[model samples]
Structure formats: structure tokens, C-alpha cells
Target: MVSGKRIADVGYKLFSGSMMLLTVYGGYLCVLRAQRYMQKQKQLQLAAQNESTASETIKD
Candidate 1:
């Protein structure tokens, strides 16, 4: 039969491992979201620049 202390140790290890996995997964999601946000910002800046250039050409 398994001892109580061994069972407790196994349970603690499993819980810690699961928590670590969840933390890593959460961090990955955050990085992906940040990347998407940066891309969107870059696209917006490019579009604004293009619009300004187009207007200037029209005026000239």
C-alpha cells in the first residue's frame, strides 16, 4: 500500500506542475495579443501616411 506522505507529495507535485503549465500558457496568449496589437497599430500608421501623401499630391 502507498504511504500517506508519498501520496501527499505526489499530489503537490501534480498541482504545481499544472499551475506552471497554466502560467506559461497565459503568458503565450499575452504575447500573441501584444503582437497582433502592434501589427494593427503599424497598419494604421501606414494608412494615415498614405492618405496624407495622396492629399498632398491632389493639392499640387
Candidate 2:
């Protein structure tokens, strides 16, 4: 049989550990999303540049 104090201690440890893991996972997801957003922005800028250049060429 476990004592009340031991049970409480174990419960607290489990809760805290799970919370830490969740925080780390959330941070990782945020980083991945940020990277994807940056990549998309870069692609959009390149496309715009290409379009401008193509138009300029036609005008020449």
C-alpha cells in the first residue's frame, strides 16, 4: 500500500514531466511552422521578381 505522501509526490512528478514534454513539443511545432512560412514568403518574392523581369524583357 502506498502512503498518501508518496502518492501525491508521484502524481506531482508525473504532471510536471508531462507538462515539460508538451512545452518542448509545442516549441518544435512553432519552429517548423515558422520555417515553412519563411520558405513560402521567399518563393513568393522570387516569383514576383521573375514576373517583373519577364515583363521587362518583353518591353525591350
Candidate 3:
């Protein structure tokens, strides 16, 4: 009976550790996604600025 309890405890600990690892990995992915999003936004803003400048030059 005691041996069975010990096995159960070990299994639970392993499962908990795996879950924590997965959570950390998920957080890392989210940071990468946010960085990509910010980079894309910056590129779009720069493109718009360039377009406006070109239009102004053409008008002048």
C-alpha cells in the first residue's frame, strides 16, 4: 500500500513538472509572436510615411 502511494506521488510530481515546462514554453512563444507583430507594425508605419513623402514630392 505504501509503495503504491509512493508511485502515485512520483507520477504526480512528474506530471506537474511537465505542465510547468509547457507553460513556460507557451509564454516564450507568446513573446516571440508579440515581437513579430510589433515589427510588422513598424514596417507598415514606415511604408505609409514613405508613401506620403513621395506624394508630397509629386505635388510640389
Ranking by lDDT: 1, 2, 3
Task: Write model 2 residue lDDT over 1-60, tens digit each, in one string.
Answer: 999999999999999999999999999999999999999999999999999999999999
Error of 3 at 16 (Å): 0.4
lDDT of each: 1.00, 1.00, 0.99
The residue-by-residue lDDT of candidate 3 on 1-60, one tens digit each, is: 569889999999999999999999999999999999999999999999999999999999
lDDT of 2 at 59: 100
Backbone clash tally (model 2): 0
Those runs of model 3 whose alpha carbons end farther than 4 Å from true positions after fitting are none
- State how far residue 24 of model 2 sits from its true place (Å): 0.2
Clashing pairs for predicted structure model 3, backbone only: none
Output the lDDT of residue 13, model 3.
100
Q: Which candidate would rank higher by lDDT, 2 or 3?
A: 2
Model 1, 1-60: lDDT tens per residue?
A: 999999999999999999999999999999999999999999999999999999999999
Q: What is candidate 1's CA lDDT for residue 48?
A: 100
| Model 1 ranges with Cα > 4 A deviation | none
